[model samples]
Target: MLLSHDITILSPALALEDCEFPAIFNFGDSNSDTGGLAASLILPPPPYGETYFHMPAGRFSDGRLIIDFLAKSLGHPFLSAYLDSLGANFSHGANFATGSSTIRLPNRILPAPGGYSPFTLTIQYSQFLQLKNRSQLIRHRGGIFASLMPKEEYFSKALYTFDIGQNDLGEGFFDNQTLQEVNASVPDIMSKFSTNIKKIYDFGARSFWIHNTGPIGCLPYVLATYPSAQKDEVGCAKSYNEVAQHFNHKLRVAIVQLRKDLPLATFTYVDVYSVKYSLYKEPKRYGFELPLVACCGYGGKYNFNSSAECGGTVEVNGSQIFVGSCKRPSARVNWDGIHYTEAAAKFVFDKISTGAFSDPPFPLKQACHRNLD
Candidate 1:
């Protein structure tokens, strides 16, 4: 049976009477990557989805990610991966998130370590522009927007959500880099990211959900790689998280300043770091355990293998190679080295539904509300 189009894209945001379910255009790293990476390349194996979909679905998690849950909670069905054309739907939204992607191109860190290329975001956006133009042509009798509207509403209301920067921190902190070098680059990184966001805004997206970096130091991969430091430790590469926070602060300020410059623009800052941190602090409440270890892997502590990944068999000695599996993934918070399980994603989405961060200074929901009319 064909699913309701509104069920896939319109319900969640429509539930919020004060907000409009603008076309959701997502851009970011693996944290929100629905399927762009795995579908493109082969890595990170089958057991990755053992507990959820019963098979791999290109997501980093055991099943879905925050983007999927958020889409559901917003009354939209799961978004179609930009790369997959089979059963793909663009009426609701499209996920442009690629694993290991960074806001800046030629990012000094992450990719070589395990992350995808920094240019992933730019590449996806270029694809988005092409798709959008094609869609316009097809729907407007080859006339584009000229035939679709009364000229004033030519540009449809759309929302752009960005969740990037974690890879940068992950690389700088763990991939043989000094804090001094990484910290020094924060200002420049933030500036470049801000510029990218502005570019998207110029592309006809007036509503935005701009996410900051999550608590990188608290990730299982980081925790296991550097176990001596506790979550509360001040100097333990908390510098990475600090950089993310600093960038978020600057982005918030910039968005506010930009509002004055462009009153019609609406920007919302999503504090993903805080939301994820809260879940880590109270895993049981979110139906998770071992928030620091991944459910899929061959390692001892973090459940990750830098040299190896989730799919396909490897040759050991002269013949047979063994694969890894999570005995109980539903109870685990993380799925692979860097992504969370769908259950964990649900917890984060629940917080967003509350509109707890709707106030000024960080106004995500407010931004959505403002553009409803």
Candidate 2:
């Protein structure tokens, strides 16, 4: 199996390797959400998915997300949301990501009008467990597979990707918690995350692609919400970024420990923070004009207003507020205050698939190969 020291020989061409894995089981929050939240709750209105999909596809961004690009790179069709019942197809895989989801269960109070959401990571896992059981039943009855694809092989060969945890920190800050207070909860947050991963691991999943939380301190919403905090050298929220860094460190360590425990398992930790930070630090280098501002939002610095949601306007004190979306979304990095544009998502996926950010440093395609002895 490829290891960290093998980076010297790895090439960008590695991304072109033949596609691997039978399917992909994805779990995350808005960052990787396709249409689960929209189908389960309310469909996000126009401008939310106008870029590529030309309609509200339930993605938090204007177009595709990093997970979409990842699926495309693997030569698989876009994974359908497990909750989307309208012509939903699980042939390729199922996406369980929902907007405003947290990894730790009890549900922290978010600044949003709803206070908190029931679609937490734990709920997603429960859905996955149910899917697995149903798949097993289908296999047993030879109803769909005709005894061809056993449930075990279906899960064992599928690639499992996680892009969660941002909401855990975001909700904490929204509730006026300090950096120290949020940092204190990192261990428990990661412990729950690790436990969920183990649940999947025990259920026949062998390949894992885990995306660490990104540099949340630089998000437009964070900057707009916490203006008093000192900015980093790169103009991001220094203290909040430190919290994200701390969490990422703990998460990486936990993944390494997981690898040690499951010797035959393939776990790839994708360093989304560094990749995203690089774009912010040097937006021009990545063809991005505005890296720290929202491409769509109401009037304010970075075009973001904390109270006003994207794509629609709300009446504030009998005044009609109009929130607008950028036409040139490809040139922008951020889509809304918290989500990223499809172009930015594609860029990150390109970088990640090159194997530079992955532990052991192998392209995603090659990383999916079974490491059986």
Candidate 3:
């Protein structure tokens, strides 16, 4: 049985009624990536952003992600990728997320070889710092960075959000580590995460909204990777979900310690696992027809073919391969095996903004509204 605390203790007053922020600085993996990967690498092929953007926007989903929804709810325009140099506007803050990023160096305890990513959390922070320094230099030279948004205004007033850590665990499993070994690495994983937050906090960021890892076991990718001996009543791999639950528990404890360490910081740990698991438990409630299957791909029970990724084809034996996307992404929860559909992302954003699953129980609006210096 999954152990969880009652989140119903939240007060109605804490719900996101009316709140706003000048900007939001996001850091994470593809779950919240707007276009960072696109700006860096070849953008994801078609069907990647067909739901909302109506074109490939480098998001792993079929449309907008949680970060996009949160930005819209806060009245800020969609954030541009920090790495996208062409048309990025950092005035409303920048997205530093990449598609296959991990919170820590992959060599810590796991055998994963992902420590070489240019878009790791550390690299993202370096990019942010460079951007901040440039803004400062421009300010000193009497150049307006973004109309009224000087370097100080953007970092001081903007909300710092994160939806990372999935890859840290994902890569471990990818490297063929057992679930027990991956579960044991959670502490080291979160320590690096907390350290990264401290680096940003040192740069004058005080408001944070960190999302915990969701049900990795329930993801079609995980299901495909580890052919389960048996599935739970909801058709999810129980062992994998348990791993997520364990990671989330340790992460919550770390967040509490982080809160205690930074008295002035308003840190909110978003319970992504529970809220997302709810959608899986009752997909019909959220208007989802297939909660556990990918909306794209081919040659699998969940339409998630490893040989043929969401849109790209792999070369094998001098033959061309291809996989197609579903016509209706709106009815699906999972997108392309690993990522969530835009509809599922919106459902999560709506619930989390209401402050029900937030640690210390404060609506995002109130949390951001409080620490405006």
Candidate 4:
């Protein structure tokens, strides 16, 4: 485990030795997307990843995600998505997250009652497989593992991070599904995701940083969709957030169990819910102005209009519904109905950089320390 402070900054090659920055392989949903699905799939652009990148970077956010912040904080370069191969070097890391993904093995979302095929976790895993193959090529000089390492040392050193399952809750709750049904099904969904994590671990990933769900109840999309519900308490329709919390709790326990099962592996839990909530409580501390209202969207509470979505037009009451946007997005917390603004993400990065690593058996810094006692 090599701590960032242990690393001596010089050149990229020299930095690798000092930092020992493990190859960062991210697997999750749109929350951690760094431009894989958006580049491949056809969708309304211009709204996503627009804050800093000035264009859709495949991320559902208007800017970077937690993964991007983590990579930079760890002294690693920005991670490239598995789908993006243009001038991208897989020596460092790659992202395998897509929008609308779920943790269930064969997950599917009925966006509009069987209107379109939601991007499933299975598809994301397939993309991850593609990334793994590419990384192998880089390590073994064109897929010849024996050439790079002895038979005994074939496994590579990588840090695999997963941030998924919010979409599962979102689809169920927002699509008029029952909370009882979601609660009953969440554990099974987590089990399937855990299996994939275990598979990655078996494939030689020694370091794992898994994120818990965010405050789904606070999302502008949820708040605006259910105006009649009490804001102080969790919305009745969005009660699936509580179910998400249950899943996250189970995930934490599973991670603990996995650590016991694999003593050599280092696992860290990133409590994104707490982090985001802290920022929302005091946006000024993080240089943010509006934490509740989304920067991009048309009129309503939470700055959201159900008929209008990012990057595309919609018809509302026989009128052309155009989603409006803020002039200075840097002052806002949320970029869209579901994602954060670049400023918000930057603020999140600041929190994670500080003490987020201090929560357990393996703080992020401790996990990265090469000379772990």
Please tell me which predicted candidate would have the highest TM-score against the true structure: 2
Q: Write model 3 residue lDDT over 1-373, tens digit each, in one string.
A: 1222222223334333454567888999889888887877658888788888888987888889999888888888888888887777777788899887788765533123334245789888998898788866766677444442335666877799998888888877877888899999998888888888889999988888989999888899888877853688888888888888888898899888887788777888889898898888999987888787888887567777677788887565798766657878888889899999999999999999977898757777876533222
Per candidate, the number of residue pairs that clash is 10, 0, 0, 6
| Cα lDDT, model 3, residue 234 | 85
RMSD of each: 7.5, 4.0, 6.1, 6.2
lDDT of each: 0.65, 0.83, 0.80, 0.67
lDDT of 2 by residue, 1-373 (tens): 3753354245433433554587899999989888887887667787888889999888989999999998988787888888887767676678998888889864544444745546787888888888888866776787645343234566888889999999899878887777899999999999999889988888788899999999998999999988888998778999999999999999999998998888778888989999999889999988998788898987677778877778678787899877768879999988888899999999999999988898867678877643322
Which pairs of residues collide in model 3?
Answer: none
Cand. 1 TM to true fold: 0.80
Cα distance off (Å), candidate 3, residue 57: 1.0
- Poorly placed runs, candidate 2 (over 4 Å): 1-19, 106-114, 139-152, 315-321, 369-373
Q: Write the per-residue lDDT of candidate 4 for residues 198-300, one digit (tens) a residue.
A: 7776667776777888878778888787676555432222353566678778878888778778777767777777777765677787777777788888777
Predict model 1's lDDT versus the native: 0.65
Q: Can you tell me which runs of candidate 4 are displaced by over 4 Å?
A: 1-19, 105-119, 134-155, 233-241, 314-322, 361-363, 369-373
lDDT of 1 at 36: 74
Question: Which prediction has more favorable TM-score, 3 or 4?
Answer: 3
**After aligning candidate 3 to the native by TM-score, how far in Å is the CA of 170 from where it should be?**
0.8
